[model samples]
Target chain A: MNFKEALESGKFTVTAEVGPPKGTDITEMLHHIDLLKGKIDAANVTDNQSAVMRINSLSVCKIAMDKGLEPILQMTCRDRNRIGLQSDLLGASILGVHNVLCMTGDHTSAGDHKEAKTVYDIESVQLLNVVNNLNSGKDMMGNELKGPTSFYQGAVVTPEANPVEPQLMKFEKKVNAGANFFQTQAIYDIDKFKGFMDFARKFDVKVLAGFVVLKSAGMANFLNKFVPGITVPQELIDELKEAGKEKALDAGMNICARQIKQLKDEKICDGVHIMAIGMEDKVPEIMERAGLL
Target chain B: MIITKKKDPNNILETVKKYDKFFLIGCSECASLCGTGNEEALQEMTDFLESNGKKVTGQLVPKTGCQTLGTKIELKKDKEACADADAVIVMSCGAGTQSATEIFKDKPVYPSNDSLFLGNMTRFQMFDERCSLCGECVIGKTAGICPLTNCPKGLLVGPCGGMSDGKCEVSPDVPCAWVRIYERQKSLDNLDEMKEVLEPKDWSAGQKPGNLSTRSEKKEEKK
Candidate 1:
């Protein structure tokens, strides 16, 4: 099903990501795509995540399409100006890779590459507006596009930003800019995500509460420290610490599953994007435990 | 007019270091873009300097640095900072730079940033220098990356092995110019679009180690 149809289906849809390596070997990607075949409504391909600059996400989308798995591609404005962004939209539409998640992306500073100059021709809100303009067969600079594109464009939100008001304001702007749906930053507290959802429901936009299966206590703490707009409760940290090394992975997965179950049961979001990161192999297992499959 | 901002505390402290009697000159025009002479920026600079070191004698006057028509009137208004002070720092662009230098030839007048270009802010805090009055723009073909301004090595076809993973080898903290070009290509999915490498740039246009300026009338007359 197309992303929007899947959204309208109201089945408590599930989504996950499978990052393609920098090189051409797709064995690991194949394995993960196969694993998620029937489990998720869609699988997202990260585009040079963390600004490391790797193999393109479009190629990975082609591989996922071959594997009979739907793909939601992540596009960042850090690299492309308005022209490239519009052309890529058309190209992705032609490939039937319909779902897209737009992000301003992690700055070059956060990635392994510190000195990369950023392309701010269009920031996130402007990017959202460009997508809207492109869908209508035009580019940002008033040039008409060669063809039109019809794709379900999605953007991200951080539910845990210290001042939730600004995130909400951007959310409103993004929705106005033609973001049909959104996937939030990872949600560790069900109540917080729900409070965000209550605020979200006031708008006419669809939302998917983001969930990342924590790998270890260290990983959880690291995210809280480095990742902006993401905060994990100390209780979850203590839970991971209690599990110890051998069982930590399983415990992290369980906590993630419980969070997903709560989101699904409470019907707070239209879907969920489980960012397994390096833990893609265990995503299906976690989803099954969460009763999503 | 030559201009500079007193944003850096050390510079402000130095400017006002020994001057117990001072005049903080502010320009009402052109220098507004740099915000050096804008009331808030100037007032803040004045307050910070006074609290940190020297006692600043009050006098902030907006100037018409380029137009000599009001030179007498402006001097009457702001001559206090120039005459009574040990040094005079004009907060204006090159016009303000030269004008201040000419007015207070014996005193101190500094040019900040060499008056790079007319720029606008990105997200307010982050500034992006856009126009370089070079009378030439390659944004159409280069996809707006501005190799002239952005590329350190000025390589047309980039990401030479020097790019150890996106970051440039020339400076580890800096991203290789070619890496940015490659990324722009990837995002547009136009990897196969542009013909291989572009010819080396003709540095002839701006290679000089001297001043550069443009006059709108020259182009208007040419047309």
Candidate 2:
């Protein structure tokens, strides 16, 4: 089933993220897609993820479609103005890529191109509204669309954000703006996630917990220190440390699979979205370990 | 007030290399407070120019450099010096530079300072941007904290996923605008307003080349 159908069917859906290469060599990307063809409900093609320029997400989405792997076209408001954003959405719709994950992307200064001019004309909530407007057979300005889109719109939330109220408020705004589902930032602490889920259960939308696989103890420490809205508990770090450098990757996979299993078994949310970063080859193994396959 | 920073002296020198003699203009308001257009700065620039083999014809610290007509009247005394100068260097914001440009139609006009943004001086010489002039104001709904200006992404609804420890991801030192708004609204017992999804901003309202007149409507009506 498609992502929307899968969500509506109340199945424990699984999705993954695939970052398009910086250069034109799509060899690794295609291989990743091939590895995840049937494993994920939909693969999200990142739009210049972390503000670093990459192959456009739309082209990769089309490639994923051609490869028979469903693609979620991740759209960020950082790089495009409303005009460009709306035009791209229409183009994506016509190109047969429906699912969109709207996000207010990382600031340009955070990326390799610090000198790049940012165009956050509209943010994530507004972008979700734009998608809703397109799906309703009209553009943002209330102009009629010649051919309307039918997109399964998604948005993101940071469940473990320190100041959770504001994030929650934005979450409700996204839902009100017609976000069908939400794939969150990397989630490590399940108990903390449970609290967020309790509040999210009131809404009609679906929530998919996010997991970014930890490669080592140092990686976990780095995430805890630098990355916002993500916290890797001390115990997980200890487990990786105990696993040592060579086996840390396997230990990280075990941690991710265990979290997924806990989230699924407890019905914390509808699904899970795994961001393997560059470890796409290990996703199927992680899934198999989680009893998803 | 409009915040500004002085351009590099070498870059400024390179820009006016063709001109040997130049007149200087500074603002007594925001630019002066920013130390980019004060009397000391003008004297410093004059000395730097003279040392670099360029002549300083004259200098003026206008009460308000952007008050183009007033500045024009004030420059009447310096007409001889201005006419003698090969160019005029404005040591103020872009608006002040344009004022000099208007007065010196034939002479080459250049800005010595880059106009940064409209901001308030939080401390002595410390400024923070408080408004983006988005035309439409949503601070009433946001408990007077302007997210459109403070938030790096200008997120209207609330903070983005990048907000952590009540700080914005753009910079750890910068507090998340929406968090401040949320807290303020909560303190006021007006958190219900936070739930209202703001409609998309009409960007055309703040479109470029914005022009406005606050003159009394009765004069136009009488005409």
Candidate 3:
């Protein structure tokens, strides 16, 4: 079943994201896709993830589709203006692509390309509206189209964003902008997530708790120190530290599995979006350990 | 105010080399403070041009360069000298340069300064960009700070994941704008106000060649 159908089925769905390689070499990426076939409801192909230059997300998604995997086209406003975004949406539809995750991507300065010009011609909320407009057979300028799209619109939210009110406000705006589902930023503190869910449940949208698989104590510490809207609790870091260098990856997977199990067991959200970063191969193990597979 | 910086003297000199006589206009407002089109700057240009074998017919620093009608009225006193000049050199921002262009359609207009942005003079001659003229304002929500101008990313809901040690990823010297806003909001105990993600700005409002009338002039208009 497609991601939209899977979301509506009320059964907890699993989605995984993949970052396209920087150069033309797709051997590793295609292998990753083969590994994830039938393992996830949908695979999100990231567009220039972290503002770093990579293979286009659309190209990667098409590759995934050719290999018989449902692809979620991650579209960001950082690199494209309205014209580019609308054209890609039309192209995605024509190619039989289904899901599209709209987001205001990481700034160019954050990535390897510090001198790149970032175009936020529209933010994530407005991008969602643009998708909705395209789906309705009209463009942002109210121009009609020869054929319309049926993209499953998705947006990202940060539950742990300090001054959570703005995040909540943007969440409401995204929902109002025709976002069908939300895949949030990496969430570690479950109770805080539950609090965010309490407010999120009021809207009629699917909420996917975002899990950034922890690889080691140092990684967790890095995220805690550097990444915003992500608070890796001390105990989880301590757990990874106790596991030490030899078994840290296993320990990290176990920690991710435990969070997934708890989120699933408690029915805290509609589903979980596993962002394994470069470690996409470990996602299935995380699922299996979580008793999901 | 609209900040401006003087163009390279050599470049301006090269443009006016074909013309023997030139008139100069400057603004006493933003241009004066920026040391671009002030009375002192105009006099310096006059001396420099005179030494370089060019006759400066007349020079005047108008009350406001962008107020086209007012500058025209003030320039009437220098009408004979202006009429003798082959070209008019404006020593203010782009807007003020364009004002001169509008006033003297018959003569070629040259700008001596490049307009930068709407800014505040933070200290003596030091300026800080405070707005992008995005046409829509959201400083009310961001503790009177403009993320569009201050944040390198222009992120409305930011302090993106790249922030480190309360500094922007782009430069360590530049403190993250969102971090400043958060700290300001926290100190003012107004953090709750920033919770709503500012909706995307109505970019059309900021479209190029923006024009609007506030209706405050309605009383005069009806007269």
Q: Pick the candidate with the highest DockQ.
A: 2
lDDT of 1 by residue, A1-293 (tens): 65678887777777889898877787887898998887788888897897787778888898898789999888886687666887887888898887888776655655667777776445566677777777888876668878877768888887776534434555766787788888888889888777888888987778888888887899989987656566789999999999998898999999988888887787778888889888888988888899987
RMSD per candidate (Å) reads 14.7, 1.5, 5.0
Candidate 3 lDDT, tens digit per residue, B126-220?
99897898987989999998988898768786555445566666676888888788779989999777666566567788889988766677787
TM-score of each: 0.61, 0.97, 0.78
* DockQ for candidate 1: 0.03
**Global lDDT of each model?**
0.69, 0.93, 0.87
Worst 10 residues of 1 chain A by lDDT: A161-170
Error at B79, model 3, angstroms? 8.9
lDDT tens readout by residue for model 2, B1-223? 9999989999999999988999999999999999999999999999999999999999999999999999999999999999999999999999999988998999989999999999989999999999988888888888998988998878887888888899989989988998899899999999999998887788888889988998799988997
Scored by lDDT, model 1 comes in at 0.69
The model with the greater DockQ, 1 or 2, is 2
Question: In order, what DockQ does each candidate have?
Answer: 0.03, 0.82, 0.24
Model 1 agreement with the true structure over B1-223: per-residue lDDT tens digits: 2234444667655655655655555676646555666677667756765777665555454656545446536677655545777765555566665666676667765543245455656553345554444335654555566654554433333322223335544456765544465567667976553334343233355554546457698887998
* Clashing residue pairs found in predicted model 3: A165-B195, A166-B195, A166-B196
DockQ of 2: 0.82
Give the lDDT ranking, best first. 2, 3, 1
What's the TM for model 1?
0.61
* TM-score of the first chain of model 1: 0.95
